[model samples]
Target: MYILGIETSCDETSIAIVKDGEEIIENLIFSQIETHKIFGGVVPEVASRLHMEVLNKIFKLAMEKSNLSLKDIDLISVTQGPGLVGALWIGITFAKTLAYALKKPLVGVNHLVGHIFANFLRKDPPNFPFISLVVSGGHTEWILVEDYDRYRLLGKTLDDAAGEAFDKVARLLGLGYPGGPAIEKAAEKGRLIFDFPKIKCERELDISFSGLKTSMLYLIKNLQKEGREIPINDLAFSFQYRVIEELLERSFIALNKFQTSTLVLAGGVVANKYLQKRFSEVSKRENIKLFMPPPILCTDNAAMIASAGYYLYNKGKVDGLDLSADPSLEIF
Candidate 1:
């Protein structure tokens, strides 16, 4: 079956076509990083407008690249929730129009779960009952995946998501928008000199970053007041270290506690080199198989949605024309 997936969950406008969900025929993404960079964050209205402008163009390109026409598409899948409602509206509306005209099944995919399923596209797939760490701009979660469409949420962020903290901190430091890459780059030149607090939560799997973000703010302000030249790179390095430290600690604890042998990493933060390197180290020492998609699949894209669509469809999941966008949809 050929599934055409459209994703406008955030600042990215993407479209992709996949064959049976595993083989990506063609995936295309139009990034709004430059536009949002000026603002140092995403503006919902701007994102929705950009989606409207480029959605059709990319949709055409994806089809042309795949050498397939609308008639060849067997199913239409779209990210329906857990994103900007305006952005989600654009993709779901487009998918709905296509489904109506083509008389095909439309599947609504959970954006977060779609990340976990991205692993299926990789050659070295992990076995069932694996531990998945999905850290993103709006979400940070450690979930236990027992099988297809079966997710047991083990833990999640108590406050701001990891990606959100990165952006907020980067902005505070003038590191730039899309904080993950900016901070990561700056962190290279510096060392983890600052002793950022490592917060602990009552729940073993639960993690908190709100305090961490606040601590960085206090440190930066105090250094400025004291006339100490802020070591920007060093601060970035230390902050990144603290965030990743919390993530690894919680994830490793979960893995051992659950007795899961496979570790799967997903979401946009998975692209961070430092985090990935650290995860690689732990996976090696623990002798657990780890599945991480290439950067292309790591971030939000239509291919992952298509992969998820295929699985959701098989699970007898189908959306009606009445299906609408949901910004805060949860994965059950």
Candidate 2:
């Protein structure tokens, strides 16, 4: 079965064609990062309008690239929640209208669940009954994946997400928007000198980055007070190191407790080279199989949504015309 997927849950407007959930025939993404960089964050209204303007073009491109028309698509799937309400609505409505018009099945998928499916796109997909760490600009969560459509949320951030913290710190440093790549590029040339805080939060699965972000801010301001300008690379390095350390530490705890051999990562923050390196080292040491999607799949995209939706569709889970976006959609 061929599934046409649409994703506009945030700044990215993407479309993909997936055959039987595993094969990606065509995946196209239109990013508004450059446009929203000036603001150092995404403006929900701007993102929604951009989706309206570009979704059609992206749809056309996906069809052309896949060499398939609407008639060839067997189902339509779209991200329906856990994102900007306006942006989610655009994709949901577009997909619903198309599905209704074509009289085809429509499936609404959770954005974070889509992120988890990103693992399957990897060369070696991890099996179920494993732990997944989903860290991104908007969310930070540890999930126990028992099987397809079965997610047990172990814990999550109480304040700022890891990626959001990175963006905030990067903006304060005049690094750029989409802070992950910006800080990563700068960190490559420098070493960690500043002693950043890594909040463990009592050895539980829960983690916190709010304190870490504040610590970075104060350290930078204090350096400036001493009439000193810290090298951007060193600052970036310190920030990345502290964040990766906390993430890996908590993930390892989960791995040991769950007795799972697989450690998987998903979401935009998974693109961090430092995080990837740390996860690789720890997984190797613990002899746990690690699965991480390539950078392209790490960020938001329709391919992951389609891949996840394929499983749901096969299970007879389809959305009706009355389906609406759930901004705080919970994964079960």
| RMSD of candidates 1 onward, in order | 1.1, 1.3
lDDT of 1 at 241: 93
Candidate 2 Cα misplacement greater than 4 A, ranges: 122-124
Tell me the spans in candidate 1 whose CA falls farther than 4 Å from its real position.
Answer: none
**Per-candidate total of colliding backbone pairs:** 0, 0
For candidate 1, write residues 1-332 as lDDT tens digits.
99998999999899989888788898898999899888778899999999999999999888888888889999999999899999999999999999999999999999998888788875556788999999989889999998878899999998889999999899889888888999999999999798887688999889888888888889989999999998999999999999998898888888899998888899999999999999899889989888888888989899999989998899889999999999999887
Name the top lDDT candidate: 1
List the global CA lDDT of all models.
Answer: 0.91, 0.89
lDDT of 2 by residue, 235-271 (tens): 8998888888888988988988888989889999998
Please list all clashing residue pairs in model 2, or write none if there are none: none
Write down the lDDT that model 1 would get: 0.91
